[model samples]
Structure formats: C-alpha cells, structure tokens
Target: MASKKRIGLYFGTFNPIHIGHLTIANYMVEFSDLDEVWMVVTPHNPHKKKSTLLDDHHRLAMVRIALEDYPKLKASNIEFGLEQPNYTVNTLILLEEKHPDFDFCLIMGEDNLKSFHKWKNYEVILERYSLYVYPRVSQGTIETQFNNHPHIHKVNAPIMELSSTFIRKSIQEGKNIRPMLPETVWKYIDEMNFYK
Candidate 1:
C-alpha cells in the first residue's frame, strides 16, 4: 500500500454532476490525506428509484465533463459493468482485485453514517477500508456509533445545501440551475435537452 497512490472512491448517482459534487471530490484530494479521488458514477442506487435518474451514459458523461478541469479527480463507470444493484462492498472488492497498487478509501457524506449499518456487509467495509466523510446540507448531527472507530475520518470539505433533485426540479420548472452546476455541464444539459 505504501508504494501505491491513496485513492478515495467518491460514489454517487450524480444524476447530473453539480458543483457541490466536484467541490467535495476536489476538497478531498486537495486537503485530505487522499492522493486522488475517483467519482464512481453509479448506474442505479439501491436507495433511489430508477425512474428519477438520468441514463447511466448521460450521468457518466456529465461526470466526465465536470471532472475535465480536475486532474487528480477521475470519473469512473466501474459500477456500470458490475452486477445489478451494485453493492459498495462488491465494488470495493473488485477494485482491489483489479488495482492492487492502489489503497482505496470510501468517501461519503456524514449523513450516510447514520444508516451505515443498513448497508450490506457494512462491517467488512468498515474493517477493510477507511471512510472519509464530509458534511452535507440537511445531514445534521453525525451519529456517534463510529466516533471511536479509527477507520472513519471526518473531512472538512465544503458543504453545499444543493441536491440533484432540486436541480432537476429547477430545470423542469423552468428555473435557473446554472448556478448549481459547472458551465460545461450546464451547456451539455442544455444541448442534450436533459431534465426537461
């Protein structure tokens, strides 16, 4: 692990990549102990309904566009080719097998910690890798259960109250969503007539 780069896996549906998402990933690479951050774009989140999300390719494209300016940050479609309802543990396992030279860490919001136990093989994930958690809007008061756990670390990344659902609604309602997203992504969305 000492010879490889410390990579943080930032998983999300990224319905349409927003500045908030990029902010967290960039902050992790720039401020945290992580050497790089990969935006693992999920095709479908078990917790979310499939109909509400954009196609996997579109979401992947948006992530790619949003990450163009960030060299240390990458957009990954690792979950797209994986099994149905791609589980985090499975993704991590595959990543480890595929890239033995990388030390992978899980990156998520503090809110997720509140329901960490609900995830499949949560204990194994906690025991095998580190978790870099950042604050999110509406995700108040992180749970104390993992406070003493050495594997979980709190990251002081910028927290944006914005959400993809809000952005999509804004777009659907004919309100401006430009402020919440990168210019390139906004342009692409407009060109593709997405979320309309």
Candidate 2:
C-alpha cells in the first residue's frame, strides 16, 4: 500500500512573504522526510494586533506569489475561511477530515517551542502528530519534557533571524528591503506600494 503523503504545516501571518520564510520552508521540504511544506497564512494571530496585519487577501496573495517557483512549497489559505482567532487544534481536526490521505505535521521554530505548552490542546497535538522544528535565535530555554521526545524533531536547519516586522519597519523607513524578499514578492509589494 502507498504511504500517506507527509505535509508540514508552517503557520504564519506572512505580512509579507520574505526570503527567510521561503528559505525555511524550502529547507524543511528538502532536508526532511516530509513530502511537502504548506505555508499557512493565519488570518489573525491571537498574539498580534489586527491593525498590524495586512489585509487577508493581500497577505495570501503575497504568499502565493512568493511560492510560485517552489513546487514542493505551497501557500495555504486554509485558515482564512475558519472562524476568527482559530486555534491550531481546530485546524488540525479540519485538515485531517479533509485530507484523509495526508499525514500532517507542524512546522515551527525553536522560539515557539518554548511556548508550545501554552497553545490550545498542545498535548493532544503532540500525541497525534509530529513537530518538525527549525533553529531560531530566540530567548528562553526549551522545556525539559520536550528533551529527546520522539515526536519533536529538532532539525539542524540554519538559524533564520529575519522577521516580517523588521522588513516592514525597513520599508517604512525607506530602506531598500528588496533583497530580503522573493523577487516576485518584492515586485508585488512595490507595485502595490505596501508598507510605504
């Protein structure tokens, strides 16, 4: 029998889809056992203010354009249709029901790992699916319980310190941030005069 396709869900606001995000998603699909990586554009992150986000359609459009060249990486607007302030648990449930043939995993950075326990039904998530974590330059130590856990795979990927916030600030400051974003994405943002 054919094995279920493995997919890593990398959730983010992606206010602007920059090269750092592309690099991480690309690395996960290339260096790991997962078949593909989906960049899930969150409509609203509970931790962030709504005013700070770009319009949902704009953010999703940026992701779509940024991933045009990467076949193994896809832009997912799955959460766009979901209820506002949706939790990861709810998304996982829906995804499982919708794609019975795919084995989904969570793709996160080392920083988020420290706060994993605080997420809604995080334990249930760990019990059911694997977490493919990438390196990040973040404060705080990981919980001891996550140490050597089979479900949590700490991949030796490069540490990406670039952030959407930084990019946005640079653009607002009239800095040349084009190199930080995908060429196509940069063009889209420039054409739209986003963050200016």
Candidate 3:
C-alpha cells in the first residue's frame, strides 16, 4: 500500500494572517518532512481570552485570503465544526477520525512549549503524535522541563517577533498595519472596516 501523506497542523486564532505565520508555514513545507501545512483556525483558545478575538468566520476568511497563493499551505475551519473552546487534543482526535489517509503531525512554537503542560490532555498528544517546534523571538530555548524526545523535533527557523496583539493594537491606534499583514488580508480588513 502507498504511504499516506504527512500533514502538519498549526493551530492558532489567526486574528489576522500575517507574514510571520506564512513564513513559518512556508519554512516547514520547504525544509521539513511535512508534506503540507494546515493552518487550523481555533475559534476559541481555552487558555486565551476571547473578548478581543475577531469572529471565527472573519478569522477564517482572512486566513484563507492570506494563504491562497501557497499550494502546500491550507486554511482549515475544522475547529468550527467541533465543540466550543477548541482544544488542541480534541481537534487532533477529530482530524484523525475524519481523515485516516493523512498522517497528522502537530506544529507549535517554542513559546507554546513553555506552557504545554497546561493544555488539555497534553500528555496524550505528546505521546501519540510527532511535534515540530519552531523558534520564537525572545523565547530563549526550550524549557528544561521537556526532554529531547525523538517525537519532538526542533525546526531551524528564524525567530519572528510579530504578533496578532501588536497588529490589532496598531490598527486600532490608526497606525500603518500594511507591513504586518498579507496585502489581501489587509485589504479585506480595510474593506470590511474590521479591527477598528
């Protein structure tokens, strides 16, 4: 039988899809063994406050617009079909069940590794799936708490300091946000009068 495709799942709110997000996804596809990278838009992050988050639909739309040109990158709304407060573990379970042909791997940032234990059923995720962790600006190194397990691989990527919070704040403050977001997404945000 033919081997199944390897898919890396990058979970985030994607309040607005930015260059940092694309750069990481592109790096994973070009440098890593991952066959494709799926940007999974989580409507609700359990650990984060939802008050400032853009609507789930809006976030999904922007992600789609930003990632449209990349063949190996995709925008997924899988979390939307599932239950609320989309936990990473639950999304993994659902994806595995629905798409048995695609071998799923988890992709996260070094910063996320700091509080990974706080995630729901994190142990199961670490044990059952392979993790590709990228470096984040000012995050230092991986915490000593985590071992250099074979399942967890460190991807050699540049540290990126951009963040959705900063982008949103700049938009609200009437500052130029063109540099932080994809042109299509920036246009969409402006046309829709979002984040104002």
Top candidate when judged by lDDT against the true structure:
2
lDDT of 3 by residue, 39-122 (tens): 998876555776778888999999998988999999999888776656788888999999999999999998888778788998
Q: Largest TM-score belongs to which candidate? A: 2
Ranking by TM-score: 2, 1, 3
Per-candidate clashes, comma-separated: 0, 0, 0
Once fitted onto the true fold, the runs of candidate 1 whose alpha carbons sit more than 4 angstroms away are: 45-49, 139-143
lDDT of 2 at 2: 95
Error of 3 at 107 (Å): 0.7
lDDT of 2 by residue, 88-174 (tens): 999999999999999999999999999998999999999999999998888899999898999999888888889999999999999
Candidate 1 C-alpha error for residue 70, in Å:
0.5
Query: What are the C-alpha RMSDs, in order, of all predicted structures?
Result: 2.0, 1.4, 2.1
Cα lDDT of candidate 1 equals 0.89
